[model samples]
Target: MTSLTASESATLERAADAPMLAQVEQWAAVNSGTGNLAGLRTVAGLLADAFAALPGEVRLVAPDSVENVDAAGHVKTIQRGDHLHLRVRPEAPVQLLLTGHMDTVFAADHPFQSLRWLEDGVLNGPGTADMKAGISVILAALGALEASPFAARVGYDVMINSDEETGSHASAALIAELAQGKTAALTYEPALPDGTLAGARPGSGNFSILIHGRSAHAGRNPEEGRNALIAAADLALRLNALKSAELKVNPAKIDGGGPNNVVPDQAILRVNMRPSTPDAMAAAETALRDAVAAVSHEHDVHCHLHGNFNRPPKPLDPAATRLFELVRDCGAALGLPPIGWNATGGVCDGNNIAACGIPVVDTMGPRGGAIHSSDEFLIVDSLAERAQLSALTMMRIAERGTV
Candidate 1:
């Protein structure tokens, strides 16, 4: 592990605790749900102001158009709020990418909108753990790094999008573009409460199958009616049965059905699939296609499948493993307890960054738990601990020119 100089150590030590937590409270108060465009814009403005403390050019880049399939099988376009991009020292020899998201799983109407102390050191609120606190950690770390003498040795591009929770449809292109030519990346996703990081992640795909059939009155001409609901149920069952050790299939929801007296003409099946490797992802896709074809032929109904694996599985390649080791070393130097990592079923933007061929250590944020739930909480002390860890890691990488 590279050692920190006296000046660098002092700068890291000055990353105050009270101010960082205060910013967390300020940001968590606003509801920046993935679907809340207006609220996301408000949060974007707040983040832009806070991140302005760094030496860079910060701008709100407009989101790209994304498509979604509705219950009726029509493709609709969605417009998301702008993503925040900050470019600092792009001309430096070593360039790194830092990413985070401003959106949360909670909606504007969600009941978990306030922040309060659950205990002496635990703060509870929506987005507090899921990522508002993580963003604060990123900003605080950057602020401390800028105060150090080696700040000019490295340059980084920060991309904080508003559509991560819903799949980064709008900001995906931006992430790929910024990640190009960078040596490494750091993403501020909150760590598990135990400080265990997520290592390899499975690739996920959400599918919506729409079945179309002929409707008829049950009492008048029951035999002439083709049951779309029954076909949808059959498809769901087939998908559920496809689950195995490598691939996990979940039939999340079904929509469209009417009175018992009339045979329903339309039905929609929503399903989620997770594949642990590239080969598994390929096999899962082929299996899904075959299932859809069989169901269409057997039920005599037109079936349409929508959605693809947005985030590919992030494997622990040699480069990624080296990056994790660097983080572990930094953690040890900062007096943090031994850090560990494990593969998780959940997917995050790290998968996308890895897809760009950039080695990334994503969950370098504060310790927190119960994300995506009303009971989510952030450990108050981890704010400063994680900031020092990230800042020191960045400084080490900048000095060494590689991990």
Candidate 2:
């Protein structure tokens, strides 16, 4: 483990706890759900202002156009809020990428707003842990890094996207672009309450299959009409049956059923899949396509499949393992608890970065739990602790000239 210099230790010690919690409270109060474009724009403006304090050029880049298939089998374009991009010291010897998201799972109408103290050190609110606190940690760490003597040796790009909660469809291109040419990356996704991190992650995909059939009166000419709903149900069962040790399949929802008097002409099946390896991911995709084709042929219905596995599996390769070791050493040097990591079924922006062949420690954020629910909470003390950890990790990397 690399030891911290006097100047570096003093800089890390200055990570203020009160200011971090205050920033979390302020940012959590706003509802910036993925679908809430207005709220996301407001939050983006606020984050841009906050990150601007660092020495960088900040810009709000418009999100790319994304398409979604509705229940009626119609494709519609989705509008996502602008994302914030900041670049500092691009010409430095070491280039790093820092990423976070401004969006949460709670919609604008959700009642999970406002902060409350669940205990002396636990603060509960929406986006407080899932990553508003993580963002604050990133800001604090970067602020400290900028104040250090080795600041000029490290160049970094900050990407706080607006569509991460909904699969990062709009900001995916930008993510790939920013990840290019960076030596390493840090994504401020909250750690578990016990400070355990997510190591390798499975590849995930969401598919919406729209089936079209002929509609007829149920009592009159039912035999002449094809039922799309039945086909969709059969497909759902088939997908569920595909689950095994290597792949996880979930038939989440079905849409497009009509009154009991008539045979439904259109139906949609929404499914999610997580494959543990690249080969497993390929097999899953092929199995889904083949199943859909068979169902369509057997039921004599036209089927359209939308969406693909955008996040590929993130294996614990040598580079990623080395980066995790660096984080572990840095955490220990800061007097924090031992950092442990395990494979997770969850996928995040870090998966994309890893796909670019760049090593990333995704969960370098504050300790928190119950993310994506109304009970989401953040551990108050983890704010400064994680900031010091990240700051020290970055400083070490900058000093060594590699991850």
Candidate 3:
């Protein structure tokens, strides 16, 4: 029921709009958060059905059983996989791959598992804004293309993956596997409220530093105690100093400490760093190690650092710039407002695909705000518009052959 301006029609995939919205509402009702195997399977079944109805052959990649440790050190393997090679045409080589994550940040026990109409046109739900809506956009746009002559040449692979919210640990290999040799990829993630898509994203890494120090009673034997907390504070200050204009280093959380009266024997500092480039990431790594060494030696405390960068930066290469310009032209053709974007500090699956050398538009979903929060909601009417833009871009690529 979201009303749109007259110009909005040109930007929307009118053919598949209604059905896609229905499908999104349906999928959103099913809680397929990354950890929910049963829900993921159920949603995958529906995805299989939809893909089967598409123009080309449909193949469901069997769900993968993956074991991982939780924050509490509990062991469990999540069920995951993808709907693969979901589309192919007779015209040219496959030029694009469409990827989405069926899993959301919400869990099965989360209270926001169900969907509801928040206003005249706005719908509120756990996954609706973040991605179920984006999935619908992907399917509906592809469905529109399938009914057109563009279907003959614009071959595409649609991968609805599991476990994207958890850094794509279980499916990173699959993402890389499918990205190989593709000209471009479009990922289904919510767009900015003004409908700006993602451009460059920083390479992110997580770090944990454990500080060990001697323990002794404060009053009885103060000289014998090597307070680790002091060393950890020094380390935190050094880390905070690493936040330059090009990179960000955050000492987010701290754990493992002792009573006030007794000298603290242990302290653990958890920090995250986001570097603008791979070299910046390396420099940050060196700085981190140096900070630990300096603080440890200066305070006579033992320290350990662990963890690594899971996703590299998605810089704006020439190919990506061309792809972005092409998308802008497609949007203009659809009569939408000028499409522009800037680099973001956040990271997404697009980084993973780009690392595999695939040009991608990761934030291709409907314009929305407040993702991963209770306030999240999509611009209900923008759904079809964004889908149309994607469909048109693919068609242009088909007509012109690799822009």
| CA RMSD per model (angstroms) | 1.3, 1.2, 4.5
lDDT of 2 at 241: 95
TM-score, cand. 3 vs. native: 0.86
What ordering of candidates by TM-score runs from best to worst? Answer: 2, 1, 3
lDDT scores of the candidates, listed in order: 0.90, 0.92, 0.79
Check candidate 1 and list the clashing pairs: none
The candidate, 1 or 2, that scores higher on lDDT is 2
Q: How accurate is candidate 2 locally (lDDT)?
A: 0.92
Q: How many residue pairs clash in all the candidates, one count each?
A: 0, 0, 3
Q: Model 1: what TM-score?
A: 0.97
Better-scoring candidate (TM-score), 2 or 3: 2
lDDT of 1 at 291: 94
Ranking by lDDT: 2, 1, 3
lDDT of 1: 0.90
- Candidate 1 — which residues are off by over 4 angstroms? 16-18
Report clash pairs, candidate 3.
Answer: 64-80, 66-77, 67-77
